[model samples]
Target: MSGDHFHVHGPHDHAVEHAGHGGDDFASQIAVMTAILATVGALFSYQGGATQNDAMLHKNQAAILKTEAANQWAYYQSKGNKQNMAELGAVLTSDEHRNKFEDDVARYKAEKEEIKKKAEALEEKVKAEDELSEASMHVHHRWAQAMTAIQIAISLAAITLLTRKKWLKYGAWGTAAFGAALAALAIAHI
Candidate 1:
């Protein structure tokens, strides 16, 4: 040992020595368990966020299409330059004007059809969005269930190391109850 508190790597990796019932085995186990839990939680959370975002984007697209439909309907009804006659229920005053008005009304009708199609498409997109969000919610529920189990497992390990009070005896029953509830929720979604 250095007298001035100099640090040194312990015997070709201290972690290897700690993976058992002696030396720092408990410390090594804690470190490995912590890393595993962190990775799983992060993966689950990312998936949940991505699915939720997809749902929101679809809702926004639907709203935009609805607005466009309203705008087209309004534009097709304005006066002066004609085309509004059919929509306004006003017959033309002469044959020439009537023929031109018929053409104009036909064009606007076609444009309105295009807008109607877009709105219908938007409705389908929104429905798909809803389904995606619901699926994400299901994933989130599963993550929560897994988290509860992980927490109990970690706690039991800690208590066993600290107090030697038969960790499973304290942790198992609560773990089962929560696990069953989570399983029920997951099955309900199915």
Candidate 2:
């Protein structure tokens, strides 16, 4: 045979050549759609992770604040006990020593008031941190939902590519739109 003999093309080669010539536009469209969806899904996943981390940090802060508040309450109780002891000492002591006990009682009472206020303020901070943690978790859940929808859309796009079905393409687009909407809600903190 001459060196210029005809060569036979395999099925795969023919399909590849056909795609390069834009003969299978549906496949190219599906390829582009899935690529975009995958990128968006990655962003959604990252946002979900970040939100979760924020929620955990806020929860930890709330717990720390609660412990501090408890300590302040314990200190306040100790001050109250000291005040009671001073009052009793004043009642039982002689006139010359009674004035010192009275002075101690007044100081302890004032210290207890200050400690009580500190404990209450810490409790309020704990409540605020708890609220923030809850809100972050809510946003995280929204991001997760968006990611799930995007994953479904990407799967649908793959199926459409395999089956060459127009309806599946439309369904994939619809699901991707829904995912985008959920991501918007997450951004809005809803």
Give the per-residue lDDT of model 2 (tens digit) for 92-153.
Answer: 99999999999999999899989999999999999999999999999999999999999999
Predicted structure 2, TM vs. truth: 0.92
- Among these predicted structures, which one has the highest TM-score? 2
Cα-based lDDT for every prediction: 0.58, 0.97
For candidate 1, what is the TM-score? 0.56
Show where candidate 2 strays beyond 4 Å.
1-9, 16-19
Give the per-residue lDDT digits (tens) of candidate 1, residues 4-58: 7987778757777565536656556655654664565455445446645655665
Worst 10 residues of 2 by lDDT: 16-25
lDDT agreement of model 1 with the native: 0.58
